[model samples]
Target: MTATASSPAIIRGATLQPRPWANGLGISHNIAQHGDGACGFGWMIATAELSGDAAFSHYPGIDRVFTIIEGQGATLTLEGSGPLRCRPFVPAGFPGDQATHCTMDGIPGRAFNLMLDRAGWRGSVTAQSLAAGHRMSLRATAIHCLAGQLAIGEDVLEAGDTMLPADNVTVAAQGAAAMALVVEVAARVG
Candidate 1:
C-alpha cells in the first residue's frame, strides 16, 4: 500500500505472519520491508520472540537494532565487544555480521528488530512516552506503539501497531499516556 503525507500506512501486529529464524532458534513476525526481492531488502522491521539461549543469525553487510519489548530481557554477547545488557525499552545496535549469542532471563521475551543494509541505509530506534493530549512531531520513517493509544490524522494506533509515514507528521496521545518506538531510516552518505 502506498502511504502519502496525509495518509500513513498502518501495519497491525496481529496480522503479521511468523517466520522461523535463520538459525532456527526463534521466530519473528515481519512488520515491513523495502527493496527488491532479487537483491534482498535495503531494510526490514520485525518482532522476534526468543525462548532460550541461542546464537543470532548472521547477516553480512547489515546493521541491526534490537529492543526488548516484553519480559525480563536478555544478555547479548557480540563478537569483539563487551556483553550487552538488553533491558525492556532499551535498544541495542550492532553489526549484523558479528557473531552474537543471546541468553534470556529464564522466560521468553519479545523484541523489536530493525535490520538495514550497510551499503545503502542507516537507522536508529528511540523510545518515547507522551502524556495525555500531548502531541509530538515525527520526522521518523516509522513509529511503533508500545503501550496505550496514539492518534495520527484520522487513524488511531494501539499497542503493537506500527505506522509508516510518507512525510513528517504529528501524533497525539489518546488517553493517559502512550509509549512508542520511533524509527528513523536514511540513505547512508559516503
Candidate 2:
C-alpha cells in the first residue's frame, strides 16, 4: 500500500515493511515499497542495544548514515581508525563495505539509519529543526521530516511528515515555535 501526497507535485508514502537481518542483530524494512516515482533510496529506524561483539562485515553495495536518537553512549570504529564515541542525536557514515564495529559500555539506544546504493543514490539525516517561515531552497535532492513539527505549506506536521524538495520547494511557516528535519535524497550522477 502507498499513500500519495502533493505540495504541487504528487508524492507517496509506503509502509515500512519488516526485514530481519544479521540473525536478529536488529530489524529493518523499506518505508517505501516499489517505485512510484520515488525510488533508489532506503530508510530504516533502528532500535537495538549496541554491540561490537556481533562482528559485522562490510556491506558491499550500501552506503549508510546513522543518527543516534536515544541511548547511553557508544563507539564506532572504522578499521584502523580509533573508536569515535557517539552520543545521542549525532549522525555519521562511512563506506558500508568497510570493516566496521559498534560498541557500547552499558546499555543500547535508538538510531535512525538511511542506506542507499553508492552508485544510484545518496542521502542524509539531521537532528536539527526548521524555523517558522524559514524556507530552505537548496536544490540537491528530496526532503522529508521524520520527527518534530514543521510549519510546512500551511500545516504543522508532527513527525513522519515529508516533502520532495528540489529547486523552488518553498514554504512559509505558520509560527516560530515549529521545528523539523529536512532529509534530502539525491540521484548519483556520473
> What is the TM-score of each predicted model, taking all chains together?
0.94, 0.64
Q: Provide the overall lDDT of each model, using Cα atoms, as 2-decimal numbers.
A: 0.89, 0.52
Model 1, 7-116: lDDT tens digits are 68999978989999988888999999886322288889999988788999988888899999998989999999999999999999988899999999879889999899
Candidate 1: give its CA RMSD in angstroms: 1.7
Per-residue CA lDDT of model 2 for 74-161, tens digit only, reads 7778787777677766677776666777776466555556666666767776655556556654442334454444554554444444
Candidate 1, overall lDDT?
0.89
Where model 2 places Cα greater than 4 Å from the true spot, the runs are 1-18, 33-58, 131-147, 154-156, 161-179
